[model samples]
Target chain A: AQSVTQLDSHVSVSEGTPVLLRCNYSSSYSPSLFWYVQHPNKGLQLLLKYTSAATLVKGINGFEAEFKKSETSFHLTKPSAHMSDAAEYFCVVIHTGTTSKLTFGTGTRLQVTL
Target chain B: GAGVSQSPSNKVTEKGKDVELRCDPISGHTALYWYRQSLGQGLEFLIYFQGNSAPDKSGLPSDRFSAERTGGSVSTLTIQRTQQEDSAVYLCASSVRTSRDNEQFFGPGTRLTVL
Candidate 1:
């Protein structure tokens, strides 16, 4: 069984400050991890994914995440947060042989303020 | 290229009424999935369909929920005797099975409210 936990339910940051959203996972096998962002009333948009390639993965909108195997964590980070970055983010995990079904975390709501 | 699309963006129904939600997958995609998002439950997988193979329905909450993909293109999710707990946003996604990346494009979703 594979599952994900988003450590923060809400994270508030000032515009132009750094942003961090923590996530941890438990998977019996090698897992594929993903970070998705959802704007208010909008469909989810894939921010990034880690498939055991590079430890550091870069995504759109200046967002990136590092997959730490030892820590069992994939934390999303952005050097500078913009007002547009305010949204709800989800951490998802999927293992092989599960028909590609995703197990998602509760989610982290990011708030960017001026 | 058009992404996944869902119909009846919002529906309000009385308890015990049956409701149907539709999804149109991306062209040439062979894999489709249904998920539900509610206040209590963040996101829950409901079902999956790939090509002509049998759909995986292990994630369905109850027997009242049923789904079908017609001609490997469009799909419909039917809920019978809906209850207040069935109110949530229904999400649909589709991906190309030929690729190992497993990136599923999502639809805007249909919001269902049971009164």
Candidate 2:
């Protein structure tokens, strides 16, 4: 079985400040992790993905995440948050069973305040 | 090039009515998937299709939910005698192939409201 957990349901960061969204996963096999962002009424957009290639992965919009195997965590970080960064972010895991499927976390709603 | 697209962006139907949601995936994409997202909830996997055949229908919530893909390009999800619990945003995604590394492109989704 494969599952993901978003440690924070909501995260507040000031514009120009750092941002962090925490996620963890449980998978019987080596997992492929991803972070996706969704704006209101918009489809999900992939921010970054970790496929065991590198511990730190960089994504679009200046977002990046570090995959920590010992801790079983993949946390998203941005050096500076912009107003446009306010959106719901989901942590996803690809389950490699009979048919590959994605398992999503509840999501973290990021609020960028001035 | 066009991304995935879904029809009937919003549908409000009475309980017990049957509804069909359509999805047109990216051109040449061989793998398609259906998911349901309830209010404030995470996505629930419904089904997966590779070409015209579905090998994994285990994610379907109930027998009333059925899906079919034709010509390996378009898909339709049919809900028979829908209930209030069936109200949610139906999302469709497609990828070049079914691999852990292949990224899935998503559609705008179809919002269904059961009254």
Off by over 4 Å in 2: none
- Model 2 lDDT per residue over A33-85, tens place: 99999999999989999999989999999999999989999999999999999
Predicted candidate 1 versus true structure: per-residue lDDT over B70-97, tens digit per residue? 9999999999999999999999999998
Reference contact recovery of candidate 1: 0.49
Chain A (candidate 1) TM-score to true chain A? 0.97
**Each candidate's TM vs. the true structure?**
0.98, 0.98
DockQ list for all candidates: 0.62, 0.83
Q: Residue A91 error for model 1, in Å?
A: 0.5
lDDT of 2 at B89: 97
Model number with the top DockQ: 2
Candidate 2, residues B1-115, lDDT tens digits: the string is 8999999999999999999999999999999999999975669898999875645898899999999998888999999999999999999999999999999999999999999
What does DockQ come to for candidate 1?
0.62
Model 1 TM-score on a 0 to 1 scale: 0.98
